[model samples]
Target: MSNATQTDRWTDSPRARWLAVAVYAVAMAWVESAVVLYLRTLTQRLDPATTTPLPPLERVTEAELVREAATLIMLGAVGWLAGRDRRTRAGYGLLAFGLWDIFYYVFLKPLTSWPRSLLDWDVLFLLPLPWWGPVAAPVSVALLMVLWGSLVTQLPPQRLQRSPPGLVWVLTALGVVLALYVFMADAIRVAPQGRQALQNLLPTRFNWLLFGCAWLLMATPVLHLLIQLTRRQPAQPTASQPE
Candidate 1:
């Protein structure tokens, strides 16, 4: 087949693209679930509410780092696979991430009905900030993921005219900072009371405002990129041009 024909054949095959997405989602889900199960086994002895004094910075475990690295690798691989074409891949990545997260909860519910409501507290991360929030928090994020995924997947391909990288990056960073602040606000307030009292501090209304702001900030880039991609154009000049 000619190169043009082969390229057209590949891009036109939506079935293949979607099948690949399914396989990737299942594989990644299995890996993630297994790792999480193992971690739970290891930390089973620790009480969720227990607040021990923070360990010395030097004493942090390699196991923790490895787990984090593994998780990133799994997520990154999905993006890498999908990003074969920038626009297509962004869509695929967004959809994959969003679906994976949503289904994680769906599958977990059968095993343990822990998050019975949107207000149930859950750990959102384990890094420096260690995000903690209600189920509604991540669900809201998943909704954004769906919006971003739809935009990326459904829009026509085009080169980014504006290249709003600086704006995008700034918004992304602000979002992360805001998320961290909101999650850790309770911990921060309780820090003055000493480590022993930290467990009693829960997220507050102000944190919810911060979370809302952060969520909107994070979504700005995706929305902007989508709008740019979907903007319509006037028809190009035909062979008969006004002279």
Candidate 2:
């Protein structure tokens, strides 16, 4: 079949859905990277380790925060459109987010050469609060998301397990809290002094031990599903052909 015909044939299949989502995320990541390059260049914060890092409160602006929230909404919308149900929708969202994040840094390296090393610190997000971490941290999470999302997307419904129970969810939430604490700990520490303190704060360290524990905790559901799928697989028959 021709390429176009083949695409049309599998357009609604999980494979096509994932492919289209990946393409869209890559293009969107370029746009995201370009926008950040412009902002950082304007603010002179591209280096990230300058005497003063990150823009001031006025320079960062409420408008920019709104834009971040909108970016998340756009990502979620793509997943919602791509999948037939909740599990697949979440899978596609995670896939898109992971690819977008990884490619953002990939594109940025050639454009700005800012993160000299994976250990370089950067302001990862600004939502209800600012999230800060080294380049390696989010990239690690993104890798996990990509792997988990791929499995969730490609597996048939019967092979998939249901969502975790309430206690598992509580643990997941705790994991999220721990990870966020690692990312935003500095900001939280300076919060008593207000926004200026936070803007001026530079992270001196990262809690790798806590982060590792949290990563494992967040992966609980994925581990459970994997075990379930493995147990369900049929055993191979021994070679015993008749004459």
Candidate 3:
């Protein structure tokens, strides 16, 4: 086979898959941004951190929450349809999420232009409680997700099979817990005040120090894998001697 034909075969399938996933994410992000813009405009929450929903539209929260949940399910379904194996499916899901989130912010710019800079504060989510943080925080994590996802999804079989150490997993969980705490600190503090308080809570400051540590801890496994790949020696293809 010619080099071009060989290069276009199975060897390139992962790249093709990655491109397709990215395309889906970007297209979905445009739609999500438009929907969010309309919702926020209606709620007068274009500035979610400080703007309380208009009194008449207060009930929109429940539907907004459901839409967020549905978006996640759609992203996950993209992974399920795109990959043949569990690991690849998971990787694609992560990739899709990271791309979608990052692009959501990107597309929202022209529609609203609210996040004037990276440090601008925003409400990240509305789950068990509200999540609040600077725009930079989630974007940083999203970039890491993209890196780790690309690595696992496109890597050779030998590298992909070598999972990170247990300690790495421990650090990952700890990091996630810490990050969540930081994001929800404001909401958690106001919980005793009642649901109305939660609805109107607005965080003015971010705990960057703690969040920075969490981000580093979360990065351990990805760094470890990268080191392994760099130090790995190429295989010698001698049948009998295995050299």
- On TM-score, the candidate that comes out on top is 3
Evaluated at residue 130, the lDDT of candidate 3 is 85
Error of 1 at 116 (Å): 0.9
Cα lDDT computed for each candidate against the true fold: 0.62, 0.83, 0.85
What RMSD does model 3 have? 3.0
For each of the candidates, give the backbone clash count. Answer: 1, 0, 0
Give a tens-digit lDDT track for model 2, residues 1-243.
799988688887899899998998888889988998988888877876666575675746677888888888988899899888888898899889999999999999998986888998888887777788889999988887777778888888767757657776687778888999999888888889987777777887899999999888777767766787778566668999999
Model 3 accuracy (lDDT, Cα): 0.85
Ten-residue stretch with the least lDDT total in model 3: 49-58
Residue pairs that clash (backbone atoms under 3 angstroms), model 3: none
lDDT for position 180 in model 3: 97
After TM-score superposition, the amount by which residue 145's alpha carbon in candidate 1 deviates from its true location, in angstroms, is 3.0
Query: Which residue ranges in model 3 land beyond 4 Å of their true spot?
Result: 1-12, 53-58, 240-243
Error of 1 at 135 (Å): 1.6
Q: Which ten residues in a row have the lowest lDDT in candidate 2?
A: 51-60
Best by lDDT: 3
Q: What is the C-alpha lDDT profile of model 1 across 84-132, one tens digit per residue?
A: 5665676677667666666666655543444566776665555643457
